[model samples]
Target: MIHKREFLRRNLPYDGRIKLASYYNSRHVRVPVKAAQITKAVRWHASLLQPVTGIDPAQLSARSLRAGGAMALLAGQCDTNTIKLLCRWHSDAMMRYLHQQSLPIFQRLSSKMFNNGSYTFLPEDWVPAAAE
Candidate 1:
């Protein structure tokens, strides 16, 4: 994935100005993308995810990327404040990401549950203490 990201960055045509996204249309015109363009790009790229993840491409939208990113941060055990800042979410809205956790979170909890010894104790009858 790191290599693919690097390759994409290297292969992409970069103008003198550094933009978040730059792409060439079939007409060979460079489109310097803005926020709205990124949404379109994300939706188009989501189609590519179907083949890689076997998910219904139609069901995935640009917003999925934000959710997935947030979930990734949650799985990483990043601080709640950091996640909120990174995600630009206000209030405790980011906590919703914890509601439907990813597999990594479940696996981590499961590992801890198994690795940590369980506590078991039987209570004995209480007896009066004698004066020392």
Candidate 2:
């Protein structure tokens, strides 16, 4: 999930020698990247995160970084509208990532709705279930 600026940076080391098309393939060759190779690259990146997160690499893809980054920005208190644009979402599609927040909101609302904080609607109504 290289952003536009980061994609440019990947070419910085090579300078003038390798132009726009250079990154299309691995270091040993100069052929255009194929789907299989790209998938391997994503898998490799996902694999590196497994040791730190205890998450299965098989469950992650390069898109995981984008989704994680969006959630991170939200957790950091960045504006939802800003995150939406940074993620290149033309619509409110980025709001989908904030789906985790929905649980907390629902719990809070349900708690108040069901007799002023005595929430029988959900067992763990006070605590956010998404964090678990």
Candidate 3:
């Protein structure tokens, strides 16, 4: 990805302006892209990935990227406030996106549950001395 960006930077005539998404027009000149175009491109790529991923192309769109990022942050144990800010979510709606936890994470958590060791308080026969 870095190499592709470098190639674009070197080949395009952006006049020192940096833009991640752009394309050459019919006149062979580079033009800035619109949000819709970017969304379409993302969905197109998702469609190409369907065969290998077994995910329906219609189930994914550019919005999936944002949702995926939120899920990743949740899995990383990021605070809700930070995730909300990063995802630009104004409300607690981001909570809904956190419903799923990866199986590996659950397995690790379950393993740690009993491996942390066990302890008990003083027995019934034990008594504390009075503080004179």
Candidate 4:
């Protein structure tokens, strides 16, 4: 994402190039990231996490973890296309889960009434009286 943004910025023929580092340095006293450091940092963070007891960390790819996270979000009622784009999945399984979970909530809310038999409204209670 950052690379794409930077590529667009640099490729545009402006009087001055908007280098990402300069943009960051201008905004903050300490620059948080440089494009060159992104890969190493991503790999280092991925390496630092311990794998599940039965799973090997080396065998796990970031893409797979992202897809699993997207699935979990769908199961929890997140918008499917948004999660799909975030996870970069090609299938509609996430959308199906979201719709299935949401249908029950919609049905329950639709069946409920604003007032039951125990409540009644009188016209006097709502209308203002005229003075003679």
Alpha-carbon RMSD of each model:
9.0, 11.6, 7.6, 13.7
| Per-residue error (Å), model 4, residue 63 | 1.7
Best by TM-score: 3
Q: How accurate is candidate 2 locally (lDDT)?
A: 0.64
Q: C-alpha displacement of 106 in model 4, angstroms?
A: 17
lDDT of 2 by residue, 25-113 (tens): 33434464455565677778768887887777677665666677888887776887898888888888777767875566557767667
Could you give me the TM-score of model 4 versus the true structure?
Answer: 0.31
- Write candidate 4's Cα lDDT for 1-132 as tens digits: 453555466584343434444433443333545443644554556666644344444455544445457667755666767788876668875554455446665565565654433555675676557877
Candidate 4 C-alpha error for residue 33, in Å: 14
Check candidate 4 and list the clashing pairs: none
Q: Which ranges in model 3 have alpha carbons more than 4 Å from their true place?
A: 1-35, 101-107, 110-132
- Tell me which residue pairs clash in candidate 3: none
Better of 1 and 2 by TM-score: 1
lDDT winner between candidates 2 and 3: 3
**Ten contiguous residues minimizing lDDT sum, candidate 2:** 19-28
For model 1, name the residue pairs that clash.
Answer: none
Model 3: number of clashes? 0
